[model samples]
Structure formats: C-alpha cells, structure tokens
Target: MSSLQFNAVLLEISNQLSAEQLEQIKFLCRDMIRKRELETIDTGRKLFNILTERGRLGADNKECLCELLREIQRHDLSDKLNRFESQSGSTDNQPDDEEKAKLDIATEVISENLGKSWRKLGRKLGLTDVKLESIYKRHPTELEEMAVELLKEWRKIRGAEARTEELIKALRACQYNLTADKVEHRLATR
Candidate 1:
C-alpha cells in the first residue's frame, strides 16, 4: 500500500484500541514466539518490533493473532481478541509480585564457583546472559524457582551471613526486586 494508505490503515486499527491494548498485543506477539518453541528471546522482540512497524493491528493481523492464540490453547485470550472490546490489557498470564523467583543451583556447581565473578557464576548456574527482570516478567515461575535454588545453595556454601546483593548481582547482573526487608541485613560494627 502507499504511505497514505498505510497510515490510514494504522490509524483505523489504532482507533479501535487503547494504548494498553497495544501493549497487550505486543506482549501477545512475544508469547506467540515462545509458544512456537523458538529458543531465543530475540524472537519475541523481533515479533513485537514487526508489529510496531505495521504501526497497529489491522483486521487481518488481529485475526491472525486470534488464530494463533487458539492454536496455542489460549481460548480465553482468543475470545477477548475476537470481541475487541475497549478492555485495555490482558487479565491472564500476569506475573506476580507474588510469584517470587526462587534461586536454583547445584551443590557441586555452587561449591566450585564460590569465589568467581557473578557473571561467571551466573553462566555456571545456567542463568547465562538473560536478564532476571525478563525472567520475572515473561517466565516468572521458572526463573523464580531458579533464584530460590541459587539462594539455598548460597547459604549452603557461603553461610547465613551472605548478602542478598551477592545473589542479586550473580543472578541478575544487578540488584533487582530486592530490598532490605527481603533479606536479613548485616550491619558493620566497629
């Protein structure tokens, strides 16, 4: 289509939804990538990027998305998409401030990597280069479980005095979703 045609199409689609709906579509596009069993997170990112390139979800695009949702057994989401009500975002698959990521680690691995860099430890623990927030957002249960295991192993190898910062940096490459209340803090006494 010509530029004007394309813009018109996008505007029409945009008019049918809210900003929150757009973001839901973006997230659904990403979830579709994972459901396809593509290994990399980049697949989801690319799908979202393509949708944004289209500028909005046209009727055909929306239908295609609903079909994909059905194929993935997300009938509720499919129904939601079908109605295209003014609802802003998805009510399901929402991650938890509730589903806290438990750290998972192997005893031998943790024992051997006690003094290594957090990055190195992350790699060794199979957290690899993926960000923790992504885990908390997209794959909450899996990564939270991993976090729990890692913390358990940390206490096993490094003892109770271990800092949450240690786990934060090691697993996420930075402190994330961590606060003093979540951990027992150690104060320095002269």
Candidate 2:
C-alpha cells in the first residue's frame, strides 16, 4: 500500500485507543521516528517487528499502528532510509581516506592543545597533572578555553626564574584558592 494510505489507517486506529494504549503507541512511534531520522532503518524495523511479535499490534491495536505509521510518514523518514541504503552499498557519497585522515589530524591538534591547558592549570593549582578523563571529572565545561588560557600564561613564565612569591601573589590577585606554600612547592617541582 502507499505510505499515505497506510498512515491514514494507523491514525484511525490510534483514535480508538485508550489513554494507556495511546501512550504506548506514542512511545513506540517516537522511538521509531528518531531511529528513522538517524538513518537506522534496520534498528527501527527490528523494534517494529518485536512489537508485532509480542501481539502489541494485534487487531485491537490496529489504530495505534496506523497512528504511528502516519506520524512516521509525516516526519519524512525517507532521508534516513536513503542514508541507510547508501551505507549498505547503494551510494557514492562516502568520504575518502585522505579526508578522513585530515579529520583525524585536526582532532589530535585540538586534543593536544586541550591537554597543554589542563597541565598548566594543574601546575598553577598545585594539583597533580592528570589525564583527560580525570580533568573531565573536575571541570567538564569550558575545559578547552581554560586550557588555552593556562598555556598562554605558561608561555609568559616559561623562560623566567622561579618567582614563587610574586607568582603566589598574582594567583591570589586573581582569587585562585592556591596558597603561597603550595605554589612554591609546585614551582620547585617544576
């Protein structure tokens, strides 16, 4: 049957369903819609198959089925369908190795810049220099920006002799919670 006709049938079925049944149908439809949008037809179809196998889409829930079909059709999951088809060897839009390599290099550059920033912050706070995972746990937001700022400051102090008292005073001026002794220790270790 045409998708439009099928959708109409589904909507008619939905109108006759009780509130709980309607909710169940809505949940199923929402999930299917999202999967379809993401070009995951196999996943969506598997879910649909499960519902049918469980007798959730029996004669009584025909309206629910129609409603779901209508919603899916209305949302135009055709783009997702095309994406799935292409991925399954139906299209020539795939990225080549060189493009993929470039993306990988860019990703690494961003990661390294972020790492340098985190180590600088760790030094300033007298904290242990930790990996990305640990840094994520401590400051999840604006991490990249903070890291960049820390790296900039580190460059400014890179060639200078250890000015522990001056550095501690500067940190205090900025209202950072590090103490003079801790800053001294951190600078000494560096």
Candidate 3:
C-alpha cells in the first residue's frame, strides 16, 4: 500500500487503543522498523510486502507502525484517517498481520533467487542438513532458534537485488566490448 493508505490503516486500528497504549504502540513500531534492523517482525515484513507489492514494519510493537508512516512523512493520511474515524466513518481496510500470520508458515525468508544456492546457504549458515539433523536430534528448540536467526539475517541482506544490479552493470560493460577475436579478424579482412 502507499504510505497514505498504510497510515489510514494504522490510524483506524489505533482508534481502538487507549492513549497509553498508543504511546506504547508508537515506540514498538519504531523498534520494529528501525531499532531491530537485523531482527525482523513478521508484521514488518508483511507491511513492507504490502507497500512494495509483496504485502508488510518495526519497533516490535503496533505504535511503531505510525512512527514508520511519519518517518516516511505521511502525516496527512494519518490525520485524514483519524478525522474520518471521528466523523463516525470507518476505513473498512486494516492491516491483518495476525491473519496473514495464520495463513503463512511463519518461516518464509526474503528473496533467494540471486543469493547462494539453498545447499550453499545452509552450509554457510552452519545449518547444513547433517548439522540441522544433529541439532534437531539433540535440541529441537536450538535448531528452531538458529533457523529463525539465519532467516532474519537473510532478510537484512539484499543479496538478490545486489546481484541483479551487478549483472546489469556487467551486461552493459559487455555491450561496449563487442570486439570478439574471431569478429576482429573478419573486420580486419573487410
């Protein structure tokens, strides 16, 4: 969603909250979006996806969502949403992180298309099949936590985007270096 639409959703949800609760939510929201840059919340990811066409925030709490909108400078939408609520109107649409969570497996990671191969990432992360099996055999919870941490780190690293950009640069460079050795001979003969 656009920042305005997102802010409207947040305001709608906040209308059900108390002043104290709102303060807490705001603080948590910031923590979710900015504080825990490496540590991600499912809500934050979902919020980001929605905005970025994947459908996704920070602080670690609800209020941080509002803080995020403000950080992006969408106060106008926040104002309009709250105003609309006061006028006995309701936004019908709201963020459904909880519902989305229920629908999902809760273990989805971000892009890996250009990142390491799954087997390679598993080895690099020290969570290889053998390693994971060993951990699960001795400590299920430990394995779970390790997997979660690795996924969080993956979310923070834009490996796929970086790789794509690198590929594009390389392609452009190749376009300028079109003098193949065989082609050069043909041109010289011409």
Task: Specify the highest-lDDT model's number.
Answer: 2
Candidate 2 clash figure, as a count = 7
- Candidates 2 and 3, the one with greater TM-score: 2
Candidate order by lDDT, decreasing, is 2, 1, 3
Q: Candidate 1 lDDT, tens digit per residue, 1-190?
A: 3344434434443343444554455455664444443332233334434554555344435666556445554444445444433222233322232222222222223333333233344454344243323223333445334444444433433333344445544534433223322332222110
Query: What's the distance in Å from true for residue 5, model 2?
Result: 28
Q: Compare candidates 2 and 3 on lDDT and give the better one.
A: 2
The whole-model C-alpha lDDT of candidate 1 against the native structure comes to 0.40
Model 2 error, position 122 (Å) = 32
Q: What C-alpha lDDT do the candidate models reach, one value each?
A: 0.40, 0.41, 0.37
lDDT of 2 by residue, 1-190 (tens): 3344444434443343345543444466665445443343233334444555656553334444445644544221222222233333423343455533432343233334434345544465343333223334435676665553443333223322323344455455544434434544544554
Off by over 4 Å in 1: 1-46, 51-60, 85-190
Model 2 residue pairs with clashes: 10-66, 10-67, 11-66, 11-67, 13-63, 14-63, 117-147
